[model samples]
Target: MVTALMELKSLRKAYGETLVELGSENKNIVVLDADVSSSTQTKMFAQKFPNRFFNSGIAEQDMITTAAGLASQGKIPFVSTFAMFATGRTYDQIRNSICYSKFNVKIVATHGGVTVGEDGASHQALEDIALMRNLPNMTVIVPADYNECRQAIKYAVENERPMYIRIPRINLPDIFDNSYKFTLTAKVVEKGDDISIISNGDTLIESIKAGQMLKQKGISAQIIHCPVVKPIDKNILKLISNCKNKMLFTVENHSIVGGLGSAISELITDEGLGLKLVRIGVNDQFGQSGTAEELLDYYGISAIKISEKVIYEMKTTIL
Candidate 1:
């Protein structure tokens, strides 16, 4: 269990501050936004480095292509916009102008998943991960909290590659401290012998809470936080292979079909782990307008719901 009290912090706020810091450190570091700087928190970067920032005025595709052009000229372009428009609206440009050429473009898409409350399904990007992960040469990262987001952004800037970082609109509890180092590997937040619960992004906090709830019900649960969605870490495969019990559950704020759960499923099947896996997420459906809290519960990815599902699955497996 985490010994310190978790502080609530905004991922986008951390991302913006990190961008400003990086901008000051690297003269070649530039930021591009698609007319949503305030919402995506890139306005902070724009304020700090006016000359290095560009607003493309609602044109996501043009912003991506422009970033690619900048990258080709040795500038490390950090692109920002709502997740839906960032990925869904500009997939062709990202695929051709960026990923195809392996341009050094950092796409930090905000307002991901169903948590963009009251915006409904159109604004929510439940399939962004799926879209980005399938693209060649694109590195996908979904940081668990503010600290991770900061580190992930720094990593993206320092390492020149075609990368996609997803940031949610809602503030999440601090899962890692300032000393925490971000890596492209799975982290075991809580260790147990009975079952393992894998998650990332906003769903990781709930997975930790669900682990606690499961412990009270005499079900020892392990919590694994996977920040990188693509290039599934070998450490995760090793952990599952050594588990005492072969049950695994994946929870995410996005759709289960092509999100973390799907990635894990591919890993298990390809590696022949033979673990019994259950996926918990938006079950092949679109999001509706509701509070962030209400939508989490409604989609059955809340801590309470996760614990309940684990208990039920355990009982059924025994029978």
Candidate 2:
């Protein structure tokens, strides 16, 4: 059954609020922002915990390195910045300084994917997931909505390792409740006999709607939300993969190349699942300035387009 109606929420707020709560509980917790605290919502933590919040002032590399230093001192640092700056800008620092040493740091990268909208390509961190996950010690998470985002913050605080959490600039719907907990696996939101619509991040809202649309056309679509993108539950992949009839579709607000799509594709191919797969996301292209809704549709990653792709595939290939 549908868990909740699409309730729009500023995920950035959740990021900040959750940090404040965690900050109060754990004195070892410190926040670092690369001067985009307001946009990324680290400002909330800054307001609550003035002494603990450090603004790195537009220096992502310096910020990450500082976080590394803090981690080495037994401080669990939660770094916040735009996704592009957090990953693409500070990769060397993260790899050499943080991931290399397995620092206890959590990088909360907001404005990930095309959701940055009017900011265009340079601001959109489409390849962040692939980049972060490739690191040996990084735990990558892409929360689907508000509840997941809050829980992910909690998860990051409880765990001790180099972690990356990707959130959005836009307000997304609520997928889970206060009771929902995140694990390193996929959550099967809906079950079906035909196909699985595996997706993560804010794009999951569209996938759920797409599932309903597919049902109207007599498609029994299974909906799966992946909170933990890396360290994917291989058993879940095995459960839904390798079926000729139950093809797989990966939906993400990221590049079809190295993001979720590529991860699953590699899994299916390497394991010899031999299942038909289609990726719905940015088609190896840069983002353009526009509203989030417009960009999503233009890139053919919207709910309507996702369902259409499945319909077309079922007609031309499945049959």
Candidate 3:
């Protein structure tokens, strides 16, 4: 295992920097934020391209409809706000105005999942993935780290489509470098024969640590980082099918239902892969006010908890 300490970087910060760069390169690029520019870090874009940036002031639905209007004028509008408001509050506008018209609007929502910390359940967006993925013509992505987030944003800007990218509030360890290329397909981070561990977003780092812990116990885990949740990657089918033990695990920062785990489960069921899946996430419960670290451990999605769950499943299945 590589023991080097990786640099920590914030996905929101990466998004802000990348937005500024993309805005400078493309005159058609415009940004819209629903009141929380500072929190979502779209204030950076607002500062750089003041003329092109719009603040809708807490009306997420209005923000979505306005973005659609911009798209109709041939401008690529990137919208930003908290994940809870971005998806849940603006679902109707997003579905009707954006997706129905096939508008070229990108929704990059930050502070996803319980990692929003002290903000509590009302602010946390545990169901945003489920809500966004169900909408027709919507491309959903939850980037794992800083570099991936940067690349994903660039990809969204280049590709004219209705895309939703979820950014976590916390700083994560750098998982990829400058040369790393972002694609819609899932990337296999580690190869193993004993079990397959699929994850994305903040839980990805925890999954990696679990893989290391499992290795010490003689368990070879195949760790797959799946950043794109919607338009479920066809390549993942083959990767999971190739797992020797047919034991699959999906870890995510969202709910077990309608999140990455549910997506993978649906794939397995549809294909009749007959793989046993153990989803690691919030078990249909609302989050409480706590530190991100505390919430992760309490929810049993931490590295130690993930490893323990995998080991327990392996033993129980063997017996």
Error of 3 at 185 (Å): 0.3
lDDT winner between 2 and 3, please give it.
3
TM-score for each model: 0.98, 0.97, 0.97
Candidate 1 vs candidate 2: which has greater lDDT?
Answer: 1
How many angstroms is residue 149 displaced in model 1 relative to the true structure, after the best TM-score fit? 0.6
> Rank by TM-score, descending?
1, 3, 2
Candidate 2, backbone clash total: 0
* Stretches > 4 Å off in candidate 2: 241-246
Local accuracy of candidate 1 as per-residue lDDT tens digits, 1-319: 3534566899999999999988898999999999999988999989999999999998999999999999999999999999999999899999999999999999999999888989999998999999999999999999989889999998898787899999999998888888888889998998888889999999999999999999999888889999999977878977765557778999999999888999999999988876899999999899999999899899999999999999999888852
Candidate 2 displacement at residue 125 in angstroms: 1.3
* Superposed model 3: Cα runs more than 4 Å off: 1-4
Clashes of each: 0, 0, 0
Task: Write down the RMSD of all candidates, one decimal each.
Answer: 1.2, 1.4, 1.5
Residue 184, candidate 3: C-alpha displacement in angstroms: 0.5
The lDDT values for all models are: 0.91, 0.87, 0.92
> Cα lDDT of model 3 overall?
0.92
lDDT of 2 by residue, 106-151 (tens): 9999999897999899998888998997899889999988888999
